[model samples]
Target: MPDYNGSVDYLKKAALRGSRLGLERISELMERLDNPQNRVKTIHVAGTNGKGSFGAMLTSILTEAGYTVGGFSSPALTGITDSFRINCREITKKDFAEVMTEIIPHCEAMEDKPTEFEVLTAAAYLLFFRKGCNISVVECGMGGDTDSTNVLCFPLLSVITNVQKDHTAFLGETIEEIARHKAGIIKCSRPVIYGGTDLTVSDLILREAKKKCSEFYSTDYFRVSDTSSDLSGTEFSFDGMGDFRMQLLGKYQVMNAATVLTAVEVLRGQRINIPDEAVRRGLEKARWHGRFEVVRREPYVIYDGAHNPDGIRSAAESIELYFRGSDIVLLIGVMADKEYGLYTDMLGSRIRKAFTVTPDNPRALASDKLAEVFRAADIDAEPFDDLAKGVCSAYEYAKANGLPLIALGSLYMYGDFMDALNNITE
Candidate 1:
């Protein structure tokens, strides 16, 4: 293949490189490139859910501490060319093109070409190193053990946000087995900060972390803030961090905040010197879009990409707590791989009018199928063929009837909703 050095061209080449879901190719590629991951401190994260949100919070806090932080997040929330980012922005198109040009020859030199994720990760490691970041926060794209991002053997710390059942085709069937995959991000010598969850699956993660010689810190060690969820934002106070505020909504975010705070304490022991003020500031400034993100007001519009049972439960709680008695109209779309009935059953009870549609992905479940799930639960659900049409129908229903509408389900349709709202982030 030609050495493509433009953003669009590079992405085309990247697409042509098929998926190889193993770390061996990435290990060899990074090794040949002088292991740039070793040149800087890193906070590696892995989990079935909340990895993106937690990573965003950690990046914000670390940046507030006056550190130049580079981050590599999977399934990009924005940008098309690269899966890597620096200071919350995607790597520049020119930089991505240049890296692709350099990486092509190296791939050709190998006995076999590197997979798409592996090549992108290699480029990111080099980019972050060259950018002079004090640290990098990396989120594993899949499970940790065989994930390409696991190449870093001695990160400054490892974080497993919260493991649940997802990616069963690769990770495993049960929660304990899934936790093992997520816990693979932990290294023997590094410290691990884990979010507190009530699952025995969480216990498995703790056990694995201890077995690996990690200094594991759990939320049980800290006093969690009781946060109130509202459209304006979430508010809570802790013993040490004092009264903290966040623009992010949801009670689950309060748990994420606790995890971030615990991590700050762990980093402080290594003399990172992140003050309590920084923690509060970081929580306020951290933005992870599409998690109960409010896109419009005056007959409000809320967008949440709750794709699983746990995520749906959290979304349901946030809506009940904040938007109670507001006539909760819902615009829903979901993926084929998810347990649609479970999510719909949980969310159906709260929805005043539920409009179901398929997202942009080929893997999207049919809207009729989703509507059937809602109807099975005795919800008055309607089906729309397209996302834009469904959104319009929901908006019209809300506008005519004077109710607030929530557009949610799969993240695949989130971009569509955001675009329809003139591309605003929450």
Candidate 2:
């Protein structure tokens, strides 16, 4: 039997084969596995941002409603195994290794080898089927149409959360093009709930739903009112569902919760039987780590994986809303292909000092290059190749100057930041 570390290493090697986005390899692979994805009811989620959080919330709601739920999300926050969850708990290492061992032989036999994501997606489906999940929430790996998880033929419902400009290289260069890709998840006659406020993008999605004969619902269906947030959590009331609170912070979360609520309404219409009390408790209990997550208090350190322009803007807005009138000491690390300059421009005025570090990935932007971008924006900036050194510098500076520290940029840097915080606090 393959050990946990060995199994993970094998998956990592498959990842080196790179992202081959298409349904053919995944379709063939799932066919060999007898298409377990079809055996279970699924709520397929797709968008540039908010897919993970939305899926997490939906999973929480279903779990609280007394249903066994399986969740699959991409670009694991902690480890590869974090991407697959049963009842909101990550898959155990032993189980992950055992499942990989079972899947590896079939993967090796494929005429065209599946990508790491494809393998993982297949594993999640099989696990969900074997475990008898009442339902599953599957977040798309990338653009919806051709994403590995799109192999689901008839999802119980399709969710498209707020389209934005990211992954332009593969999805498209424009918002309309990206929306088309996102809308690809809409299956014929299935209900789709979209949370995006962009008129152009929303219209495209509506059109796609019409073309596919899918029922379409929008955020307009539910209004989020009396929204409030602090370091603890966010509080908001949705139409008919009053006074809901969530551990997930930011106004963006209110919008995401609205999407989840809208989805619940549709599910109820389909005879899912989710209770109102379950919805309230689920929102309050759902936790999505590394998004405006506060790690420390004295020096006030926050870590947010806001790598894109729109995401960074939302992070900046949340910062201003939460810590208004306080200057932020920013620690940033990002990928080479991200819109780092735009990120700086969006939050530059609010930042008092900046420390840049390279994220732990081959595609990470060089620390010095990131520093140069910040410097050109006229913010005091320094670069460090070593993430530990960068964290130390940012921490000490924030402590000495009495300013809050915020770490932003790539999700890949989250582990490094957490390690740094652990070292400092210990």
- Candidate that would win on TM-score: 2
lDDT of 2 by residue, 96-152 (tens): 888788888888998899999999999999989988999999999899999999999
lDDT of 1: 0.79
Worst 10 residues of 2 by lDDT: 219-228
lDDT of 2 at 345: 73
User: Taking the tens digit of each residue's C-alpha lDDT, what string does model 1 give over 1-426?
Assistant: 323345355455665776667778888888888899889899998876787788888888888888888988766544554356677666776777776676667777889777767877888788888889999998888888889889998999998888777777888888888787778888987898778575686677778877988787876534755657678888777666578888987767887877887788889997897877777788889988778888788678888878888888888888888877666898988888887778766676677889999887767889999899888887888998867778877887887787888877877676677665563223
TM-score of each: 0.92, 0.98
What candidate 2 gets wrong by more than 4 Å, as runs, is none
State the RMSD for candidate 2: 1.2
